[model samples]
Target: MLHQEKISVRQFTILVFMYTLGTSVIYLPSLVASYGKENGWISVLGSSLIGFGVVFILNKIAQLDEKKHLFELLEFIFGKWIGRIISVLILMFVIYLLATNLRQIGDFITTQVMVQTPIYVIMIIFILVSLFAVKLGLEVIGRTSEIFFPYALFSLILLIVLVAPQADFSNIQPLFRENIAGAFLAVFPASEVPYFQLFVFLAIFPSVNKPDKAKKGFYIGVALGSFILFIITFMALMVLGPDFTARNQYPTYILGKKISIAEFIERIEILVAIAWFFSIFFKLTINFYALSLGVSYLLKLKSVQTLTTPIAFFVVILGIILFPNIIYFMDFSQFYWPFFAITFGLFIPLLMLLIGMIKKRKQGNGSQTPS
Candidate 1:
């Protein structure tokens, strides 16, 4: 296999930024408010710090052998059988992530946009478009993002600007005086959603054209994305109040609906919704890329093109059954997912770094091949 699909570090950075904002932009304000109350923005800061550490850890893992895919590197660090076991475990998480993101798009469209469309129909259409993006290959996905990513940012900035005037400083009053533990507790939950899932990039790290710059890009993207998330959360609390923001499933969307500039700019939420669609689409595309490639590696397949369809079908099925209801989904994301995320996000990466560093020392330590 030639393994020739390469993406620029710039594009890699863009993907990271967009992926970080994906669904978090739509749902994070409420999640944070439920936990952190008035200090949700502070929680975003704590999460961003943790995000920096995550990037550093994953960057070290990639440097273990920038030429090898994540599965190959795992096998080198843990040997054949254990590595395969770990790979399967990681892919299971990947499937859950893919299914959840797909389910989100499905639910959002049906409930918020169309109001009458079947969820399955929405999931199917979304998966098909994402399937095409993934099958076209990573480079194509990267380039397509280059073309459309700006509008997402522009809309996002406009969202922030328009929503800023309505903010009430008293809504976020007391300045971290109440329920401070809740604010600290909110850190992991905020970080877990986007920061933890970044390991998906390991599957495609070997495809980066410039490893050094791509590493920087990862950090920059996380910083920027977390800042964006913080601003959104702050505005949501200031504009909607903590109680209202906490109860709403999609505070960011509601913020959009409230963007009435002199009463003339009414209901441009659909325009803002376009930005959400793009962000989530790119996130799904990158994640499905990892899922397809990981499965291909697990199955020892030479090509993943044909595998994409069946895998997408499986995702749709899991998306349907994964959550009995959105309430269950939100509960899982809030109360339980932080613990689940750390196993792969922190534990596995740290384990690999420890073992790989030990192995490198034993082999004279100049980035030589293990075994």
Candidate 2:
């Protein structure tokens, strides 16, 4: 039997919330504004329902096998070779996600703050920091997220509070304009990425102390995270209006730039940037951790620690390949990439769930006693 670490439900919940909210909070508003116009918040709220529904389905899968990771469950249902193939595909998908996110962060920092620095340098630094966090293991990662969660939330709220004076609610008037279809389309990427990515949590199920509470915690974490995105999206539209937001690469950052609580307290975008960095840091850490854990399970490695460095290197390479330049990356994200995400994140998992259910019924509902 593989030895498993234990983590509290609260810790797990915070980890999921932080992981879900982290990168999405930075890009979600701008992405949604592209379609929803002034009614982006409606799309955010609407998409969150889809996000939560994905979480609920994941939770149901987890409940069916108290201690088994999704990969193992897949093997049980689909037989060894096919299950291993699925596991490898899932791992590749996660690696792709990690790379894409790293590229986005690199692009953001390079274009916005560090135009002089080579993008590779920034990517290396971020990956190294995340790699170090993953080496400390999931318990440490969970605790770190718990500590930083408040600051992330505070920075977001502070942005809203400071920007309140400049906010023109009129910008969001005539809600639900003719772009209803387009608005929902915008919500798909933002909602699906964070929400469906919770499938990675299936890798960490054995580490959760009270396995039964996994469902409850997963739901709560995703809901809270989605709500945060909704609020931030609404604030961005209200503060900057959809037209300006869609034009800006980082609408949330622009919202921060607009804050001025008296002349002495201006240029607070740096503070917001710092807060956002931590959020992204936690997010990268979670992704790296998931990658490490998944690899450890697949290869039968005794410890996830051994795989972190090599995997971080792998991620850096992926980041480089993900985009020739920021413009190309953004264009891909806007047009082609979302359908791909839906295939791996939603369609694959749903198919596996059905297969697992049928396999269980064929086995006469016999529960395999844990060894």
Candidate 3:
């Protein structure tokens, strides 16, 4: 595939940061707190460390063939038949990811702010908006991330400061009450969903204008995004306490509701929620972009843009079916999603790397033949 448009290193970094923050801000804090309790911060740190490792793996794989997108690299390294199978699995995962995110945000809005609105209505509208963004091309998505960067930052900082007065260090007293095993279990979900899912970025990595700087962009983006997540999880524990944090489906939203001033300032939860909404929009757009791109590549289509609408419509329909209710969504997210993530996010990439190395070695030996 031709690299027709390119995003600068800065833009790429911004996209990474936003994408990492996307689903994490709302969902992860509660999930981690539920498992690790007062030790949730440890789980957050553990997840971040694992996330960094995943980023390193992805960046190295991208380096293996700096010129080719991930799908092409798979085909190049694994041959046509196997590569097509891997590509199909990855494509399916991205679409499922897109659907879950759409379902998540839809659930959030209907349950919290839009009590009168239908859930499907919310999901469809959000899907349409994100689909339009994906249709504009990756360059546009990159630039859009730059514009949203400051807003996300400001809202995050503002929320932390606003909620600081409610902090109780005592809530986290007697650390490791559940011991290391519980925190370790929590770490898997925390890391897997937001961080490891970055595997999809391999599809987008070749679009970086400065291919050499791509590694730097990936590191900076993941570091910054994960740090923010750590802070949010810490704050949720400190302010809400682990019990309250875990009980509420959207702990961060409740955290938002707690942002009260002496008398006048209040009810800015919606404003804070917008930050998550914007971040998830970028996440959905990029994932949808990757899905469309993968499909076009597999089918030998001339342009990925051609399939955007049809794929997006399918995503909306699939989103409706994936989660019948919030209970099932949360159950899948907690119990099943991490393993599913590992299959595509961890195992597949590692297999590709191992196979890629073998292929390179064979080619090297062939070139040294006496004939």
Candidates in order, TM-scores: namely 0.97, 0.94, 0.97
Which tens-of-lDDT digit does each residue in 1-371 have in candidate 2?
33266778998988888878777888888888887788778878877888887877777777667778777777876789998898888888889889988888898899899999998899999999998888877788778777887887788777777887887889898876667887877667766668767788887877898877867888888888888788888888888889998888888888888877767788779767877788789778877777777788789988878878988998898899878877898888777777877877788778877887787676664665432
**TM-score ranking from best candidate downward:** 3, 1, 2
The lDDT leader among the candidates is 1
- Ranking 1 against 2 by lDDT, winner: 1
How many steric clashes between backbone atoms does each model show? 0, 0, 0
Candidate 3: C-alpha lDDT: 0.88
Number of the top candidate by TM-score? 3
User: Where does candidate 1 stray beyond 4 Å?
Assistant: 365-371
Ranking by lDDT: 1, 3, 2
Task: Flag the better candidate by lDDT, 1 or 3.
Answer: 1
**Residues 1-371 of candidate 3: C-alpha lDDT, one tens digit per residue:** 64577999999999899999988888888888888888988988998899899998998889888888989998998899999998998888898999989988888888899899988899889989887887788888888888989998899889999999989999887886555687888888888878879988888898998988989989999999989899999999999999999899889989999989995799899867989988999899889888888898999998878888877778888988988877888788888989999998889889888888888888889989966
Task: Give the clashing residue pairs of candidate 2, or none.
Answer: none
For candidate 1, lDDT tens digit of each residue in 154-271? 9989998998889999998899689789989889888998999998888878899988888889889888888888888989999999999998988888888888999897888876
For candidate 3, report its TM-score. 0.97
Error of 3 at 49 (Å): 0.7
Cα lDDT, model 2, residue 305: 84
Off by over 4 Å in 2: 1-3, 365-371
lDDT of each: 0.89, 0.81, 0.88
